[model samples]
Target: MKLVVQVKLLPSPEQAVALEATLHACNRAADRASAAAFESGLFSRNDLQKLVYAELKADFGLGAQPVVRTLKKVVDAYTALRAAIRAGTLGRPGCVRRVKAESKPITFRLDAAQPFDDRILSWQHDASTVSIWTTAGRMKHVPFRGNADQLKTLREHRKGETDLVHRNGKWFLVATCEVPEAEQYEPVDWLGVDRGIVNLATTSDGHNHCGRRLGRYRRWQARKRAELQAKNTRSARRRAKRRTKREQRHATHANHKISKEIVAVAQRTGRGIALERLDGIRDRVRPSRDQRAALSSWPFHQLGEHIAYKAQRAGVPLIEVDAAYTSQMCPRCGHTARHNRPTRDSFSCRRCGLAGPADVVAGVNVRNRARSAWVFVNTPVPQGI
Candidate 1:
């Protein structure tokens, strides 16, 4: 499993200034490389390296690795733009934004051959600090702290490149760690999980994690956001942005908690998990304006992603099945009709007279699908969200 643990850095004022200057120098180089790449119509890393490597190194007084990393960022942006254009997701290739020294994340690309074995960037075991390479041609030990779980991972499983991020007057090191995959568990039965806007998640065992509180929070945020926009003042805008970030954090934390609960349920019951295939759901449905915001704001995809990784980390079997009629189909008698779900939150099978929470019915149907497909594909495969 791959996860990023964010460790907060505590740098002295002088050290902070040096870090900021370095960030500015790197971003300036990146912007120059971006302009060159787009104007020359050459986006390959090698080509970009040839174009700006020496100039950026001498002009910005940057190291060879930082120059290469900066140019690669430009190359990656153009590459993604070209791909999106070709895939018809975008009409045309767009201009890459100039990296702002104040806001852009400064990535320290550690060489793969060297790995992160504490040479360029290493942890000081005694000081609870990290020695990071800077543009000043010296390594500075910056004290850092994090939550117990994050610190534990840094002490034990730190690996790969770390990104230095400056946000709201704080420095953070986002470090990615590679952990061994969990041992696979034999499945006893299938656990169906239905994700919806009304209820964040519904399990086949008749559990509903409702979203009323989230909905109210969103509505409140929307109103405050509108008010802030009306003010059009700098402070109001800043406040609005901060509120939005807070709301996002709340939602993300809620998702993690909900996913943890679902995984725990599956683990305790000794069952695999089955979820709806939700790819491209947003584009597939057209809702009224009144309903659109709620639907669009729904975190079904996020919930699914969280559940997937957590389930994988716990060695719980998980699979996605087609979601054609899982919502309306009768889990008890195999009856399928839109009228089965006459209301948004209620479901009744006209044929079998079986009725219950609409989400639970959907959950049951998903479980049935998993049971039917168990013979073909039995184990969970960890994949990207």
Candidate 2:
């Protein structure tokens, strides 16, 4: 398993200026490479490299590997645009946006994992600082701080190339460390997680993490934004931006707490987690304007991602089951019908007179479906059938 640990960097004023200049230079080189690729219709990494490598080093004063990284940046963007165009998600390759000189994240990729192992990033455990090569031809020592675990990794198991990034008025070093996977354990019991807009998640064991507070916060934000738009003042615009950031931070905190609780529950119960495959439910559903806003603001995907990573870190098995008919089917009697769920929160079965919270019912159904899948995968076909 590859996990990325982000360590915050504390650079001196001069070093900060040098790092910013390096970022701008890298972006300039990326823009030049992108333009050349678009004009010449050559988008391969090798083609871009052949065209811009030497020029980037000579003209932009970038290091050798940074030049390659710049060309790679442009080629990746062009490749993504071409893919989207082919997949019909985008109209044409021209729809791709140009890399901004300062807006895009500025990164300096290390030469290899050897640099990290050799203490190029962490000079030594004694110093607790990094030696970064800059355009000024100077090796700057930038102090960094992180948790004890991250610091231990930097001292011992830090592997692969590191990316030094500047974003949101701070500098960070992102390093990917290879962690060994835990021994696989077949789950004896499964914990079903039903994710939806009304209830963020409901478990088969009768835990409901409703999004009512989050919903109210979003609605308040929407109303506030509307009021600010009506005023149309510069400070109002700035306030709106600040509000957006605050909302994001709040939602992220809530998600962290919710995912932590869900994982703790699963771990304590000695059960594997089962989640629904909700890839494109938003595109499939048609709702009223108010409902649309609520649905669009739902953080189901983010919640699922948090659960997945936490589960993996905790050595718990996590499986995603097909979501089809999970809500309509009755978990108790196997009765399936749209009328089973007449309201957003209420669920009732016509065949067995079973009734419960709609999300809880869905959770139960998800657990059963996951058990079925596990059986199908584990069972072998008999010979001479």
Candidate 3:
């Protein structure tokens, strides 16, 4: 399994300034390339690379090597950004368009391919400090007095992180690591997953996972955002930037946790996962204004992506069945009717007089779908349903 682990980069003041400048230039180059691709009707990576490389060398007079690295990194951003846009995974294009309009003037990408060295620790821990090395020469360290759990996590998982930045002020690191696929165990009789607005997810097999706790943190963030909007002051802006960083960190943590839980459940049961195919969920979810404010704060698509990757790594097939009537279906009698789901939490089948918690019923329906698919496909049944 491919997983990314991101640790902070600690650079000297001079190096930090250079890194910031490089990121700024890279963003501008990316913006220009995106515009050029949209205009020319040739929106491929090769086209983007050509546009960014030419613009960097001719317009900016950067060296060919640096220009090449910058172009490569920008292209990676472009690929991710464009995919989000095409999949309707991001908000409107206004912010990106605005960035393109105001171009920045440095750029960098990795200039040389280097072999992985095991001696280089991804993260290091002393009595009261933790450090992570990005390259052989650059390392970032954070101070924490005493946290054994954190130290253990840092030691075991630090190597998976890679830093990537979009602009000067906006920086992020992608953390991932490869895990060997688990051997197939006893065939699974069933797997059940529950997805909802409040809790995010719970499994019938006694595992619970929260979706995005960032929504809770947003209450504290709202004040900072308001202050920034009112005064347009430097401190307020910095606070706003910090809040955004916190939100991203929270999101990454949530994704890692959810992915880990899902993979664990699949491995333990040796069962195919059953999840609702929540297509067009954003459109369907109708929350009150306050609820919408909280709901929209989380990244559901990112969670789904984590599950997909981890499931693939574990050799666990994840089935995305139609969720149209799962919530209303009577798992005991196979009675599916709209009126049976009169409330969000309660499911009462009128035909069979079978009733249960709405989420549980839905989860059972999902498991049944997976089992039925296996049966139809003539896959060997797992022992003990």
Residue 9, candidate 1: Cα error in Å is: 1.0
Rank order (by TM-score, best first): 1, 2, 3
Q: RMSD per prediction, one decimal?
A: 6.0, 4.7, 7.6
* Residue 213 shift from truth in candidate 2, angstroms: 1.9
Task: Using lDDT as the measure, name the better of candidate 1 and candidate 3.
Answer: 1
Lowest summed lDDT across 10 adjacent residues in model 1 is found at: 108-117
User: Best to worst by lDDT, what's the order?
Assistant: 1, 2, 3
Highest TM-score scorer: 1
Q: Can you write out model 3's per-residue Cα lDDT over 215-304, one digit (the tens) per residue?
A: 566676787788787988888788788778877777778777877787777777677787878877778868887777666765666777
TM-score of 1: 0.86
lDDT for model 1 = 0.81
Q: Counting only residues 3 or more apart in sequence or on different chains, how many pairs clash (N, Cα, C under 3 Å) in candidate 2?
A: 0
Question: What local lDDT does model 1 show for residue 136?
Answer: 82
* Candidate 3 wrongly placed segments (more than 4 Å): 12-64, 74-186, 210-215, 223-238, 285-288, 351-353, 379-385
Q: Which clashing pairs does model 3 show?
A: 3-176, 3-177, 4-175, 4-176, 5-160, 5-161, 5-175, 5-176, 6-161, 10-140
